[model samples]
Target: MSILSLQGVVAGYGSAPILNGLDLALDEGDIGVIVGPNGAGKSTTLKAVFGLLAVSDGCILLRGEDIANRPTESHAGRGLAFVPQEHNVFRTLSVQENLDMGAYVRRGERAALLDRVFEIFPPLKAKRAQPAGELSGGQRQMVAVGRALMSDPSVLLLDEPTAGLSPLYMSELFDRVVAVNRTGVTVALVEQNARQALGIATRGFVLAGGRMRFTGTGAELLADPDVARSFLGG
Candidate 1:
């Protein structure tokens, strides 16, 4: 069964719609990558799923339940977490403190969750006392992701996690994404690095004009001549 499904979804910021009845489904333990041009509604899709935008039509199903119009705060407890592309962390807060904030909605012990987060992003462990603003871009990204993990979400929505990083950091971030997925969290990510993002994806979606133009396995999309020429820069 699909863990998350978007059926004929239409969403937008105001009256102008970005997603035009888009459809997508992601099974459990899948790393789904969305890649497309700048205005293709890639980020909008994540926003819709996270309930940050208004959906005028259709529904977003999480674990077979309709969660289309729910508020953003309501998502975390339902096993959904989202990390936006920028300004994701509390710059003034310490690393540990930032993670603690992520767990504010939880009523259970957070120590184990913190340990797991540190294990996933080991660099965070050594700098637990440092301010998030002081970390490098990649480490800050880790903190952002780690903060989301503190909520113990079953599905993670990442909007361009590798947005402003050096090539080395981008590669390392992808590796960390895979590591996170390996631990059974379903991942849906939007990325500008088409080739690299699709390289690690279990399922790849190519969007154009706010609609999916192509959908396939990562290897299948990578191997397609048309997909390579149009989206992967040949």
Candidate 2:
């Protein structure tokens, strides 16, 4: 069974729906990438699923349970974590402190979780004591993702993770995303770097005008000539 699925999801800022009957799914341990033009509702999908926006219609299922329109705070306990593109980390806090905030809902044995996140982000281990705002953009992005991982989620939602990143950092971040998936976390991410994002995706979705125009394995979508010409900057 799929780990997460959105069926005919309709959501928006006020009354105008940004996601118009949008649908997508991710299997266990899969790296699902959503790519498309600006205003295509790529980021909006993640927002809707993470409860940043209300689902006016349709269903969002997490491991077969209907979770649409649930309170945003309630999502973490249900094994869902979201790392938004902007203002994701607490600037004044130390790296370790930022990560600690992610586990606010947890009880004991937090050390192991810290170790796990540091293991994935070795640079964070060295700068754990430094203010999060002092770090470079890539490191900040890492902190944001690491903070989300502290929740130990089964499904992670990332919106435009590589936005404004240098090419080197973007490539490195993608490597880390693949590594994260290898550890059995189901990932759904919206990326502006379509070609590279799809390269690491197990499943790839091409969204246009708030709807899925194409869905396939990463390799399949990458190889599709039409996908290249229209969206991949052929």
- For each candidate in the order shown, give its overall lDDT on alpha carbons: 0.94, 0.93
For model 2, the stretches where C-alpha displacement exceeds 4 angstroms are none
Q: lDDT by residue for model 1 over 100-162, one digit each (tens)?
A: 999987748698889889889999999999999999999999999999999989999999999
Off by over 4 Å in 1: none
lDDT score at residue 59, model 2, on the 0-100 scale:
97
RMSD of 2: 0.8
Extract clashing residue pairs from model 1: none
Model 2 gets an lDDT of 0.93
The stretch of ten residues in a row with the least summed lDDT in candidate 1 is 104-113
**In candidate 1, residue 227 scores what lDDT?**
95
lDDT of 2 by residue, 143-208 (tens): 999999888888999999998999999999999998888778999989999999999999999999
For each of the candidates, give the backbone clash count. Answer: 0, 0
- Candidate 1's C-alpha lDDT? 0.94
Candidate 2 clash total?
0
